[model samples]
Target: MSAGVELDHVTVRFGEFTAVDNATLDIKGGEFFSFLGPSGCGKTTILRTVSGFLDPSEGMVKIGGQNMTGIGPNKRPTALIFQNLALFPLMTVAENITYGLRVRGVDKTARTKKANELLDLIALPGQGDKLMSELSGGQKQRVAIARALAVQPKVLLLDEPLSALDLKLRQHMRSELRSIQRMVGITFIYITHDQGEALTMSDRIAVMSDGVIQQVADGKAVYDDPATSFVASFVGENNPFVGIITRADSSYAVVDTLFGTLRGRNPKGLKVGDKAILFVRPESAKLGTGAADTTFSSKVKSVAFEGNMTHVFLEGVGKKDVTITVGRHSSADIPAQDEIASVTYDVDLGLVLPEGKMARE
Candidate 1:
């Protein structure tokens, strides 16, 4: 059965270095929750804390409403799947899957039955006798998951298990993992730096940065309505225009940017004279001046066609070059390099946020 996890005011410190800073989160039972951030953002530390591999310096860790302060990883009702997998090379697939059961003194017949059942569960039926060295990378990944599931853990922690796979295999395993999680009905706490992996697999994602939880929301909300400049810049590609707020209201604000006066949704409710940045997605900005609240013309620096979509880089709009994505159907209308192109975006689509630290590429 699945169990909920709770971290109340959790903080972890190694000597003087604080890795996780007072993070509070409630993860639902049987939910696929992901911790997403760049490297060294303390996501792995938080995962270790929940799995009882590391204790929090302050606050409480609870699983299924039971306090886990003094519990060890082996005692907790959880299992961890490391990035390296750590499978035994000499063992058969069946032996590797039932290693945990064998260590617990389970009889040979019972262990064999369990291993065969798990092989079927992971879609490797009748292949249990094959050596670990004989399986493909993707097949080995499934066997690793099967081994973790052998002990019937209520919560499974994955530390970038698919990072070593190729792009095609990684994408394929994303769906496979989600399907397996649903079938088992266990809480999955996944740690990953890849935005695509988290967004595609998670029911909810917690965006972390600099040992802080920046925002916790679903993938769509995190992508469309970011709570901070760090999240807006980190979660996806965006064109940021630095400016000062000239006018403000409840829903919208006008900013005096280098390009010109532009309007966008004022999500942070910044007042007039406040320093701000207007962020617009490349896809939201169209190559035209008609029917858009914000419009500007700039010289096209370059254009690259990637089959289905075209990327047009515009210069002289701001300190950084602005990117616009043109669809394949509209690629014929794309302006040549050195030619001027009019860029426009609707007020509802753009977001005006307080100026703060932006994510480094």
Candidate 2:
């Protein structure tokens, strides 16, 4: 019973401040879509608009090809799960799961049957009779999900529902949520500021900033081929080398940096003489490789020993903190503090973008 959702030229404003700028997006039914961004970046605003808690100042909100103009949340075929689970303290697990059915005047027998079915769906079968306080954090989360799903909403909107759990539990819930979505075949519209959560669960991600969507793509495309400088810096750890482009073409660009000329993919189509930033991921950087398109001698400032991979911080290059990641099992020697090291990276792995406002800046 999943339904498609669409925002056509949507804009939400609170008084003079525009919370969500003009944004048009189409979300396919049964797809796990996520809206990811920093706080106050209009992601939650869009979610609220879709949930019918707030109407857009301009444009249209549609679900299943029907315009949702002047529609209240209760009338819409959607269920929203907030960050706080908001379960009734005195209610039993079955009572919480069947609250919506009870509100609609379903008989106790039918409600209990529906509750047990949902408990089984959430992998918490046979635990319905227990009080809500008896369940653990992860278990309570599942009960909340079952409560929402019990209403059979075509579109389920979640706003950072897993942010309350511990790191391990949060990770566990990510898989659990995805599995539940696949099993129920409902369209899940998730809103989150956590990059890992979005990347781990979403079929497609819309990265928002300043009330605008910077990019909408799968996890790999968003991380590897960012369309903007903000996306390049926000999605992952990147070493940025700011300089003027010396050469440019459809596929590649060379930038004159502090270390020397560095070559990378010309994704933003910057021309020669344009100010640009070349982004190199730590994993794409190698140590002591002369075959790379860019090579610079750097002094090791520090090294973080992570299992399986070591992050080597380099100074005297790129005019900022440059990091290089190397496999711990590599035959190359790990550099120590103050040790002079040679850093190299393939040109294609570097994303060259026109100089613009960065996410951190």
Candidate 3:
């Protein structure tokens, strides 16, 4: 029984400081929605506001079309899974999973039955008797999720629950969590700064910056069609060429950059003479000149071969070095150090946006 969540003109202020500034969002029922941003971007504040931990200073909060003005966290139909996962070490796995039921005075037999069912649901069948310390990191994570689901919450809020796990385990849990959410059919509101986690698991993502919602779209849209310069620079690797637009049209813009005059897709509709940045992704950049719209010559500074891709660092693209990613099976010949190379990219793959705040690495 999943429920939709709505925040209408929500604003949360801490005296002179505003944590969330007039953010309006609609999270559909049974959707895996994620709020992604760096720390201090008000993602946690929005989560707390939805969970009834902190009431918005202004505007309305609704759950399943019901206004939650006076409702407390305990009364709300949402369950919050914190980062630390406060499971009691003294209690057995079954006891931890049914602690919420025990607090409501459920019969011992019923609680035990519910615990076994949840253990099975979490894929830890017949492990109810194990202690908390006996379980692995990933197993403990599953138990925490089972405990949260025991109360049958309509909406489940997770605050970076996988941040503590290692890289491989975190990647594994992303799929596991998505599977669990689908099995139970509950609305999942996940908060995370990790782009991989959000992009991998979420049906839709809301990217926030400085207490403001920058863009709300699917993972592909956020990566390929960023609305702001911060988003284009933040979400992935990009080579930004800052210059003034010399020519503009409905679909394309030509910018006079340090390297040379470059053309790219003009989504922002920048007028001629306006300062802009042409962003080209490393993977989209090719070492040799083909039929690409833009081409530049640079000296290869270095080349590093990763397992699957080779990164060729080049100079002469201005103060900042340019990176060209070549796949292992790429047909282009790898250049040695100090060798001049031709870099090319199609205009359709490059983004020309108005100059704005760039994300720090």
Candidate 4:
């Protein structure tokens, strides 16, 4: 059975450098979880700790409520598929898949049966006799997974398994991986730098930056309700507004933006004198009639329409640019530059954030 993973105040240090700062996280049993961050942000370090590949400098790593303080990678009930699919080139598919059993002294018949079972499970039935180099890129990836599954570990640790594939193949593999996890009912802890991959596959995602976790939530929540400026900027495209809180209330707020006064919903718990930033997704802004309660203005500076959607750039009371997305139906013959326009959005769509990493950067 797959097991849940927990890190209680985990920290990893490399001499003077703290590769992974103090972090605490929990992974539910049989859930597909991902650690998502850019390179050098210490996602790999956290994955290593969970797999028992690296000992934590502080705190405990627990799986299924059991502490794994001194266990080695192989000793834990976990299987790690490294970024490089380290399959033995000389071994045939069956041989490579069953190599772990051979080491444990399983007879040839049992090994072959196990290999065939896993080959079918990975959707590559009856291909065990083929050479490792004979498969396509995606097929080779499945073969690597089959080899790992042959061990029947309780948890699977994948380190950017799809990073090496082309874009189409990578997209294909995301669905494939999620399906396999469901079929096997195994917990998957994936580590990747690609936000798209993590958003697509994970049940919950932890966004990390500079060894610290920024936010952990479902894909849509992380994208729509980011907790920090770094998360808002990193998870998806956002137009940022930096302004001091002017008129404030629990239900709404008005900010004196460079373009004009932005009146929108306020995320409660802000004092009158506090400085705030509002983040709006490109899809949230729209070209429409002005309203006293809306957050945008009517003046549009630029408009471009891709085949799929229309991208409108608005220059109003804000120092930075504001962008909005419209459906092709809504894109029909938008007004030209210096023409009268009305840009608006629901007050609830606006967010209030402190000046954060993204603001400083």
lDDT of 2 by residue, 1-361 (tens): 9999999999999999999999999999999999988899999999999999999999999999999999999889999898898988898999999998998899999998999899889889899989988999999999999999999999999999999999999999999999999999999999998999999999999999989998999988899998888888888888888899999999999989887788999977789999999998999988886654588777899999899898899894545678888897777789889999998888789889988767763
Q: What is the C-alpha lDDT of each candidate?
A: 0.92, 0.90, 0.92, 0.83
The top-ranked prediction according to TM-score is 1
Return the lDDT, model 1, position 183: 94
Off by over 4 Å in 1: 291-293, 316-319
For the record, the alpha-carbon RMSD of candidate 3 to the native fold, in angstroms, is 1.7
Candidate 1: how many backbone clashes?
A: 0
Model 1 lDDT, residue 340, Cα:
94
**How many Å off is the CA of 214 in candidate 2?**
0.6
lDDT of 3 by residue, 1-361 (tens): 9999999999999999999999999999999999999999999999999999999999989999999998999999998888888888999999999988998899999998999999998889999999999999889999999999999999999999999899999999999999999999999999999999999999999999989888999999999998888888888889998999999999999999887888999988899999999999999998877543498778889999998999999994546689899999999999999999999998799899999888876
lDDT of 4 by residue, 334-355 (tens): 7687666666676678776665
Clash total of candidate 3: 0
- Candidate 3 TM-score, C-alpha based: 0.95
Across 165-254, the per-residue lDDT of candidate 1 in tens digits comes to: 999999999999999999999999999999999999999999999889999999999999999889999998899888999999989998
- Error in Å for residue 30 of model 3: 0.5
